[model samples]
Target: MKSSEADMVFPVLGFTPDGDIWGFPDLDTLTSCGSMTLKKNMQLDMELVDSRGRRWLVRSIRRLGRARPLVPWLIDLLLTAVPRFRIEQVLEEMTPLTLEEIKARASAAVELTSEYYCAEDERDEILVPLLDQVRAASDVAQIHELLGLDSFLSY
Candidate 1:
């Protein structure tokens, strides 16, 4: 790929679990490539869209960076039972930062979804807190309640 096209791929501000996890979504009306939602935690060749509508996959990130649309993240989907994430540091920090703080640094990168149109702003508001909760949560059922995802997760 050309340098410009390659730039579209990385130095992503990846928010991930502290372990090697992978997934699709429970409330999956917006999953990438349509219809891989049943695969559970396997790393399929799927696109990941964040709540703010960013898209890409956990592995898509270049050694340098960071996405698709406005939907719940795949990592959260991977571990439906308990959602959690820490910034996957391409540049290690002395101490870890919170999702909100990292979002602040990433600005439009991770905070504002890749302009999916409707619900972009709302996604940011709903997203951070939900992810924070994901980091702390211990049950899938509880995560579903974050945005009434239970409506879909249970379906």
Candidate 2:
């Protein structure tokens, strides 16, 4: 079933190395993809149309900025400092979706990215450290462990 804008609750989705997820329903009000007119920012939209022409919206988007890692790391530190980090509340605030849903949207995003940008042959240049975080971790537990406080505390 296609989800309309009304049916979806969260608009902004972001992830931390510690597998911390932040869902901001009002992010667009603060930061925006800018106008859809600019080719540069168009891909920021989570909207994707499938082969069947069904539109699917991905709630989460990778945060891009120089301080992306530092910001999430700081937030994680502050959040963990407060002991009562309820998993249920985290899950509720996070973008909750089935594995299939995540896969579909992820594939769609890759498709769009691949189409827009040319792939580089130099493996080193192509390999992004942030993307590496997602690629290296196989599961949620692994992601959290890799992104845990111990790692951030070092830096």
Candidate 3:
């Protein structure tokens, strides 16, 4: 491949979960191709339309860094439950912190939560147990109830 074509295959701001480089065309081409690659890999095709009304196929790949080992169960547990109210309640119960401090804490919490979901190992272990604790907390239950399941359940 010529340098130009090679450049098309690889674009800027591209990194895989394992820290491998993913090369693509220019930003537009990369965006188009990333969608195609994800769809092909996932065996599910979805239509993606650009602002100009051009249609493209797409798929999504879950990328986890070193934090890959804790995601799925985390998603299944916490993400499935917690609502915004519970989050706010937890924040309030933890004692009044400044908004900036709360944001920082929330960000860290989200990162840890995402890490738990991205984990590869399905087996229950130390991390899983701790995550389960968070999931099982009363605040989490309130959040789940607030979110509701009526739409998800159909008669």
Residue lDDT tens for model 1, 1-155: 21122222122223333212222242122222212222242223323323332344433212111122224446544555332221121112224344444334333332333233236667657656655665554333233343232111221
Q: Which candidate has the top score in TM-score?
A: 2
- For all predicted structures, in order, the TM-scores are 0.22, 0.26, 0.18
lDDT, candidate 2, 28-122, per-residue tens = 32122312212222223334322222333443333233222566646755665421111101112223554344333333333344422236653
Any idea how many clashes model 1 has?
15
Which of 1 and 3 is the better model by lDDT?
Answer: 1
Local accuracy by lDDT, each model:
0.31, 0.32, 0.28
| Residue-wise C-alpha lDDT for candidate 3, range 38-118, written one tens digit per residue | 323421232222112222222333322211135653453465442111000000011223323322332334334444334
How would you order the candidates by lDDT, starting with the best? 2, 1, 3
Ranking by TM-score: 2, 1, 3
| Model 1 segments more than 4 A misplaced | 1-118, 150-155
Best by lDDT: 2
> Which stretches of candidate 3 lie above 4 Å from their native place?
1-11, 34-36, 40-155
